[model samples]
Target: MVALRVGLALGTMAGAAQAEGVLPYRDADAVARGERLYEATCATCHGRDLQGEPDWQSRDAEGYLPAPPHDQTGHTWHHPDAVLLDIVRRGTAAVVGQGYQSRMPGYAGALTEAEMREVLAYIKSTWPDRVIAIHDRINVEAGG
Candidate 1:
């Protein structure tokens, strides 16, 4: 009975982990589609190579901050997948609330949820192995 309970518990934990980590980063086709979608939808503000905008850390005269890079140089990897997906779906202003102003517009109207996941996967695919491992850890820590 104890052994059966242990097996069930382990199975539940594995299922939870799978549910939390849903990005298809290893799928080459999804990554390619994501790259193209990113270029079409996000590159103008974030940069063609995900380099983001100049002076991204500071607010401009109008109080809007430039888009931050999605690459390792930026803090994108610091967040778990769920938070990143929310930001993409709701925009920075909506996510940060408290009257924070941003130039980013949510893609909720333009992209489907699966497409958003693809974009995030593409971004993750570009990170170095170390960064990817760190991001995986972040997701684990976030219970995502």
Candidate 2:
């Protein structure tokens, strides 16, 4: 079972590496679509500018953390593309199991896989070039 899990993990990493470059950050059409999707679906909590909530690092009275920014100021760029997609598709609670609590609800029912990709691409498009380069390196390292 352990070996199987390890194999699956490795395969996932490899797939992530391949998919990292698939985000159409440079594609104007995709980025525009992503922006629209983000505004309609994510702006309430994450902010219209992707600034997230105030004191996002701190837990609220209900013990739930606020949404983090997807811009360079946040840690969103730190994760590989595949991980980001999975989180969006599965929600934070489902992805970070073991009783992790999050207010982030999965969008699997609300968004298509391509739409999810577009949203992520929009987020990435907002980052500075340096951050984007660093994120690309992170994806490469994760693949290896």
Candidate that would win on lDDT: 2
lDDT of 2 by residue, 10-122 (tens): 99887765645658888899999999999999999999999999999999999999999999999999988878999999999999999999999999999999999999999
Over 4 Å off, model 2? 1-20
Model 2's alpha-carbon lDDT is 0.91
lDDT per model vs. reference: 0.90, 0.91
TM-score for each model: 0.89, 0.85
- Candidate 1 at 137: error in angstroms? 0.8
TM-score of 1: 0.89
